[model samples]
Structures are given as structure tokens and as C-alpha cells.
Target: MEAESRTFADAEVNRSLTPEDKIRFLRDMYRIRRFEQTALKAYNAGKMGGFLHLYTGQEAVAVATLSLLGPHDHIVTAYRDHGHALAVGMGMNECMAEFFGKATGCSKGKGGSMHLFAVEKRYWGGHGIVAGQTPLGLGIAYALKYKGIPGCCLCFLGDGAVNQGVYHESLNLASLFSLPVIYIIENNGYSMGTSLARSSAFRQLLAQRAEGYNICWDQASGENIYEVRAKTQAAMERAREESRPTVLEIATYRYYGHSVADANARKYRTPEEIEHYKTYHDPLLLWQKRLVDEGLLTGEQAEAIDLGARAEADAAMKFADESPFPTEADICADVYSEVDEPAGDAPRGTHFFN
Candidate 1:
């Protein structure tokens, strides 16, 4: 028999979650919304640079999924990663600094918005190229298994990358060796102005793609944090204990265009679609409303949380504005790891041209 469909009402009634969990979930989702809104304003004002991909309507997907990992585990994602970085415990000031191109940023002003790295946080780093992180994720899982470490690697990619050769190869290798890695395909419906329907010939669900490689399949609404958290917990348990790899596809939508540069998402899809999502299926608003209805949070309390988030976002922009730009000497120092490397050389030091 086919499995039953799970709705938001089902998650609300069936999932086991605490009051504390709900509170944190709502707060974090609101925070992400606030941050993204602030970043858009900064981008418009030219305070922050680079291609900005706002994670406007997909906050819950990143927050709930990444929360499953402990400090020892690893995470890697695509360019739409500021939300993931925040959910994994990177401070707002540093994240904003990175977008500001300040030396104090997470990647030390080198990676910018597209490529963010926080190795200490075990976030691995975000990639700019489509499906580029797949091989890197497989390598990380292989290393973890080789070292006999018990931690899993959580690799995230957009629907656009799922069709790439590296993703399939990574799945084959991961499942073949029982590598402990959970791959999350955030399907926001559009692959840079083209809908998934246009790109892929197969109209079947994405999870079924896992069957070819023997990887287990899981699916959930990216808008539902509770469902996402519950499903991610099960996947993490299987990965940690059984040394298995699972493919999770999250059905989600991005309110903005492919990047901040794409104004109002008018190039490909209609503005009506964006307005519909904003009115009905907004991830942050859905969770907040649910929390209020469940009596876990009062409307006033939720409003307070939103105000607090707005304040924090404002502080982050200010922090980014005040942070100093990367100096010339700093850039020259980290240019090449070894003097023999193809990229240039240091003038006096072994690695630097100075």
C-alpha cells in the first residue's frame, strides 16, 4: 500500500516536540527573515557586495535540517547559505562582515557571499559552482569513515544540482560504501529562472531518483519546521548508527529571484506566483501562526520576537558597515599556500610576494 500523506496538521498533532523547541524554531525563522530583509536593503544601498541570494521563504528547511548535527558532524551547501551558516551557530556580525568584504568575515573577505567558510564550526564552506560540493561532501564522508569517526556529513544542494553527474556519482559511492552522509536537495521549483519541470525530463518525485543508487528516500515540506526536524532526526539516527546515506528532498519556494540582481522575479515566473507564496505559504509566518494557535506563544510574544530579530538585523548591518575592508598586505599573504604553486609568489616570505 502507498504511504499516507503528511500535512501540516498531521505534523502538528503527531510530531513530538517540546515548547522550548517550538520557541527556538519560531525565533530562528524570524531571525532569518529579518536578516535576509536587512541584507537586501544593504545590497540596494551598496553596503554589502557580491551576488546576494536571499533565503526569504525557505528558512525552515535550513534551520530544522542542520539542527540535527552535533559539533563533530560536518555541513556543506550551495550559494544560498547565509541561513544555513546562521543555523549552524555562526554569529551575525561575522556573517555580515563577510558580505561586507571585511577581513574579519568568516572567509576573511576572500570568499564573499557565494563562498563562505567556517571550518571551526564544521560547516565546511558553501560552493559557488552547481553540484560542486557533491564530490567534496563524498570526500569528507570517506575521510570520516577512513578515520573511524562516528560523525555524519550533511550535504545540501539545490534542485538544479540534482541533475549533475557529480550528485549521482556521489550517491552511488556514498551508498555503495555506506558512508554516513545525508544529502538534502532543496527544491525551490526554479533552477535560476527555469522551473524544475522545464529542466528535467522526468516528472516523478525527486526522492525516487535515490532508488537507482540504493539510497533511502525521504521527503517533507521545507516550510514545516516540525516535520523537517522530525524527519531529519530519523535520517541522522540511521546515518550515525547504521552508516547509511539518505536523500531528502524538501519541497520549497523562494520568494525572490535567483539572486538579488533579479528584480521581483519577473524574468521567468509570474509575479502572481510570488505574491501567492507570500500570502499563503510563507514559512516563517506559518510557523509563527501555528505557535500562537497552539498556545505555545502569544501573538504579543511572537511580535516581540519579530522586533528583537529586526533589532539584531539592524545591528548586523551596522557591524558590516563599520568593519574595515581587507588590506592589500592581507590579500597578498594568503594568495598561495606554497611558493611553487602556479598562482604567483611572495616578495620576501616563502608564500607571499612581499
Candidate 2:
């Protein structure tokens, strides 16, 4: 497939964003920021446990791409998925409760930091295995294509996952079958502790690899919400109308460490490098600046959004604390598939069980 001529710089920005849209974008970013900040605090306070992947800096990509997709469209992503869930309309309280391992969680507290799911909203899960969700995402797209559904599947993977064999295989199948799937490479430039340079011999031209599979491809600066929204809209449109696979390489950065426990303390990259990226390419701040410069939002309005997000996150934490944990019986319930016993698998007098 050929690379799309439309680059991120060519993406339309001024026209697509209304005042209300700008405000909503800011609010969404604030919500993600506040939620992750609270999650970090909870982790330190020993309330929330497990590997917490904070999506502090990548809010633009989440908000932008999610806004372009329809409710019926499905999303499957890697472990870094809290932003994806929230962007897809998962309730903050439910997400917090899930993080807290309460029954009120989106996954009934079964899936902690990396297993959030909302089937009704078509948000599949936060699969923990690196690149494991690629095949599953392609399968979902295949099913959608088979059913003649008008929805596309957006599969998100880290930069590291591109090196996985499943990634290439899934891309090949998706392209060959003309499946309605968009493969998004969230290139935060690290695979856990290993930098992308050290991990992959091919380095960082993700769209080029997608081209080898005959899939339409594009790259976007994930720091800019407008660029993300525009590029994703184009790719999604192609997928829906043409029933073809597309790839979007989002060059993003993570503000926090790979996981909450890391605290970004280990020195793989220089402090100067991290600071440079954070200062220049901070997604939330970029959007905030745009909104303010365009006269769509004032500093006061932005502060209010931040304050509101913090309060909302605090309320969610309280709700999760008050909520009960899942019962032991519920454990055997969601993990297994309930199907009738085949043939004489079950005794004649006993009913089938999962």
C-alpha cells in the first residue's frame, strides 16, 4: 500500500475545531491527566495495586482518534489503555473502581490496570501481553467485515509490538482481506525499559513497514490533537468506505515511567532529553495553548476544567473505596466460556457446565 500524501502538517486544524469542541478536548485531556495523577497517588498510598501505565502525555492521540470513531466501532489496545477507555466513554468512576479492584469497575474489578473492557461500547480490553491483541483486533475486524458491519476496528500497539511476528502477520492478513481495521502504532519510543533504537534494528519508520504490506499508511504528531483527529478521520474514512486496512503511526511520548513503580527513575534516556520532550511537546499544554490563542478558551476556563477533572477523579476514588470487592464465586464466572457439554462429556443425569 502507498503512504498517504497527507502529512500531519497538512492536517486541517482551524476549521475542524469549534469552541465547544476545543473545550471538550481540553476537558477530556484534563480528565485523563487528573485520573492518572490520582492513580499514581493511590499507588503510592498503597490503595491501588498492579502495574499502572499512566497516559499523561499522550492525551492528544486518545482524545483525537477516539472522537473520530463511531460508537459501534471497536477499539483494542495494549496495556497502556486507560486513556483509550476514557476516550471511548467509559465512566471515570467505573474506571477508578476497576483500578481499585472493586465490583463496580468496568471489568467488575477482575481486570486491573491493564484489562479494562466495555463490550457494550465496543471497547474490547487492555491486553497485558505485548502485541497479543494484534491478532485479536484483526479477528474483530474480520468479523465486522464478514457481517458487513459499517464499523472499523482500531488496534493500538506500542512501538515495541511492531517487532513482534504477530504484528506483521496480522497486518498482512488485514491488508490481504481488505479488512476494515486501522493499526495505530503508539511510538512512545520505548518498549518498557528498552528504547526503540536498542530494541529494533529497523528503527522508526512504521508507515514504511505498513506500506510493505500494501496497507495505506500515515504518520502524525500525537502531541497535536488536531493533527491526530484529522489523520485518524482520513484513515477511518478509508477503512469504512473502501474496506481497506490503514496504519497510523503516532509519534508520542510518555510523561510518567513505563509503569507506576518505575517512577521514570532509571536512566535509559538522559534527564535533559525527557525534559525537552515534556517541555516542548506536552500534548495537553499544546491543546490548551491552541484553545487560548484561538480565543476559544480563557486561562480561567482551562483552570476550571482542571479543577473539575480533579474533583471528578476524587469522587471516583471515593466511590471505588466504598464499593465492595467481587465475590469468590464471580471469579470462576467471567474467566471461562459457558458452553453445553459436547456429546457424552457430561453424565446423563447431570446438566452441562462451563
Q: For model 1, what is the alpha-carbon lDDT of residue 321?
A: 87
> Residues 232-310, candidate 1, lDDT per residue (tens digit)?
7777778889989999889999988899887546878888988999898898888888788788999899999999999
For model 2, which pairs clash?
Answer: 1-214
Write the residue-wise lDDT of candidate 2 on 154-265 in tens digits. 9999998988999999999998999999999999988888998788776358667887899989898888776788888888888889999998999999877888878554
The global C-alpha lDDT for each of the candidates, from Candidate 1 onward, is: 0.84, 0.86
TM-score of 1: 0.91
| TM-scores for every candidate against the unseen true structure | 0.91, 0.91
| Native-to-model Cα distance after best TM-score fit, residue 170 in candidate 2, in Å | 0.1
| Superposition error at 13 for model 1 (Å) | 13
Where does the lowest 10-residue lDDT sum fall in candidate 2? 1-10
